[model samples]
Target: MRASHNQHLIHEVLQWNGVIARRAHLDLSQTIGRMLRAGELVALLPGVYTWARWAGDPTVRLLAVAAWSPDAVVCRLAAARLTFWPEVDHGELDLAVSDRRCSAKGFRLHRRRLPPEHIVGWPLLGEDAATDGRGIVPITGPALTAVDLCAELGGEPIDRVLRSRQARLADLRGALECTAHRSGNRDRRRVLVESRAEPWSAAERKGHRLLFEAGIGGWFANFEVAVGGKTYYLDIAFPHLKLAVEIDGRFHEDDPDQFQSDRERQNAVQLAGWFVLRFTWYDLVDRPKVVIAQIRAALARCRKLAGIR
Candidate 1:
């Protein structure tokens, strides 16, 4: 077939692979090349191809990559994306493949012999099967992909994965429930349950909660206090004691404008007689007890000074 004609055929196949594949006797190579040259297809892996920008769906790219290596299973952040895990960025691509001989361009590959239970159908990919470099194929379903990613990445990438807003507890539970009857990896599943038990923003919340839990209640969260009619919110506060806490995220240091604004707020709060306690992510994560103790002591001092104790 001519490249243009082949490109047309390829588009037809991408839309409905089984129908076109059975109708066209054209070799896969010529069709794939035409699709690539025409910018009608993106090579996800060596043999797998998908319509370029299939609505900017990462799953399409994932499936295309998996199509190139039929044995390849989507994993890691890519798998998280498929499962709708929150906080996972769509930019990174990850796949697992069993075939050592198969390799692809612009993909991160994990080689392993995935059992049949790990593989599942994709109704959206137009073919029930995933594409191997040579033909359409099947791969790990969203649930298994999510489980595999959580098991593989542990806690390190959990923050980013959660941030993507794709993966949710409901989806993770569904994936885990699907594998409930199967044996092995019970510990890994337990880890997933624990890791996801709290929201990814747990650290931020915990910093605020620690003060209240430590009997330093009466503090407002994101409490808006104004001076000169300009209002600002405090991460944590004790208005009665004229105390405020500000959680300094890393972004505060990196952005100069934000840093300056923060300084202005600090100055304004000080003029209002509010003693500010600034904490960082490191303080929240590393020294929770110390941070809470400091706040408790500050509260005591404030009470004494105000004759409230």
Candidate 2:
């Protein structure tokens, strides 16, 4: 298509206020009609059409949606999704708009005014346009996205906060700094700090600490053992007693090859006469006492076999 026609299409999709001149050469309305009739484009929102089968970045779609509504801003999990922060799995679009605007049928709209500080610089479709696909509107930055998530979570889902593989200490710190500068909610700032203090996958660390607290001796954190001239790492190990403990998370069961490899390693260790104990998320969350008991029993058996108290 010609550059002028493409601009006209974008303008039509965005419902630009300017009147089209009578002398304009390309008929935008007919062009759009033909494209839709041919299945070349689909209307994702009123006045917002995308090419059929355009499975480009979700951020791009969100940006297009925001373009369809100039007043809309990205918010909540939608913003976090753009920044690649792992938290809640919200499958819907969340947009923030001026309080005077009514919520759209398919979109969740939060009515609030975003301060200049909370808004970050993003490349909109136009040069110097103040929007991005990363958040409610492109105006939401990484720091704002993190703060919004922390606020929404009430800081309780610490594990999910840590599991955000994209969220870094620095990003969180930057968000907090912005929060402080903007004088946002004090409680939210405190929660952000607490969230930043530890890794996202803290459940694993907590499980490890609980075992130590339960008086399980000879256990080392992140312990490496050399068996048959090959190095293997254990979450917890009593090397002298030939005991190994493996802590399994949900993702551990998802990978068949890793599961098989783990089984082989366990067999090799057992063939060497070492006791192997495995713990899962269920064990850690629902049956801590049972986990400790199992470990203690394994240690006792190892001691008995070695003739040691």
Query: Please, what's the RMSD in Å of model 1?
Result: 8.7
Give per-residue CA lDDT, model 2, range 1-110, as digits (tens): 57467656645743431122212324565666566787866665555566666524464457555546666677667666555554556677777677645544446767
User: Model 1 off-target regions past 4 Å?
Assistant: 1-63, 66-73, 79-92, 96-156, 161-245, 256-276, 281-290, 298-309
Residue-level lDDT tens digits of model 1 in 103-185: 55556666665556656554444433434323333556554565665555554344334445445556556666665644446
Task: Determine which window of 10 residues in candidate 2 has minimal summed lDDT.
Answer: 16-25
After superposition on all C-alphas, the RMSD of every candidate to the true structure, in Å, is 8.7, 8.4
TM-score: model 1 vs. ground truth:
0.46
What lDDT does the true structure give each of the candidates?
A: 0.61, 0.61
Alpha-carbon TM-score of each model against the true structure: 0.46, 0.50
As a TM-score, model 2 comes out at 0.50
lDDT (Cα, 0-100) at 274 in candidate 2: 74
